[model samples]
Target: MRTDRIFGLAVVLGALAYIASAFQLQTSFLSDPVGSRTFPIIVGSVAAVCGLVMVVSPDPEPDWPHGRTWARLGIAVLVLVGYAYALRPWGFVLPTALAAGIISYQINPRPMAAALTGIGLSVGLYLLFKYALGLGLMALPRDFPG
Candidate 1:
């Protein structure tokens, strides 16, 4: 089978599992209208749709990435994993900024631009999540001094 078909099938299966698991999440009586399962279901649905698109309309000749590109992809994955681990200890802003900066630099190879991009993204996302979405995310670590 084509690589895209295989990847799309895997994504579709994973998304189905994710949606199913989301359905199993228990919610309190006082939970909001949008329950815990809502977001996960939405995400899974989106993923499944995208996977279906890829499966149905894959590129005739996908240009697979070469050596350096593969290495960069690996680094990006590592950065994302590190970001997840650092969230509890470092809080949202710092680790997010660092990860965004690293990925931006990898994409553009411009230090100053990447730094600014990271700062902008972290602050913007923080404000959007905290204020607009009314989500309570830590700006800094609990032990972090003002």
Candidate 2:
């Protein structure tokens, strides 16, 4: 089996699991109009469809990454995981900026640009989520800037 097909199969299986788990989410009368399970189910469904497409028509000559690229990929995954853990304690901005900075620097290898990208993306996403979407995300920790 081709690597892409294997990856696609994994994605399909993971998406199925995600969808199944989403069904387990308990909602109340006070839940949002879309409900808590809706987004996860939609995301899982989309992922399943994309995975099926990849399984049906994978790249004939997939140029797999090598050497430092693999390291960078691993680092990016670690950063994201750390970001998830740090979100509640550190709030949104600081951890997000660090994670985005590291990942952006890995992609571009430019310190200043990466810093700008990190700060810009962190603030942009914060505003978009908090203000535009009316989501109550903490911009910083309660005692921050003191």
lDDT of 2 by residue, 13-54 (tens): 999999999999988889778999999999999999999998
User: Residue by residue across 6-125, what tens digits does model 1's lDDT show?
Assistant: 899899999999999999999989899898899999999999999998899876767789999999899999999999899888988999999999999889889999999999999999
lDDT, candidate 1, at 133? 100
Clashes of 2: 0
Q: Which residue window of length 10 is worst by lDDT in model 1?
A: 54-63
TM-score of each: 0.58, 0.57
The lDDT of each candidate is 0.93, 0.93
Q: Tell me how far candidate 2 lies from the true structure as C-alpha RMSD in angstroms.
A: 8.3
TM-score of 1: 0.58
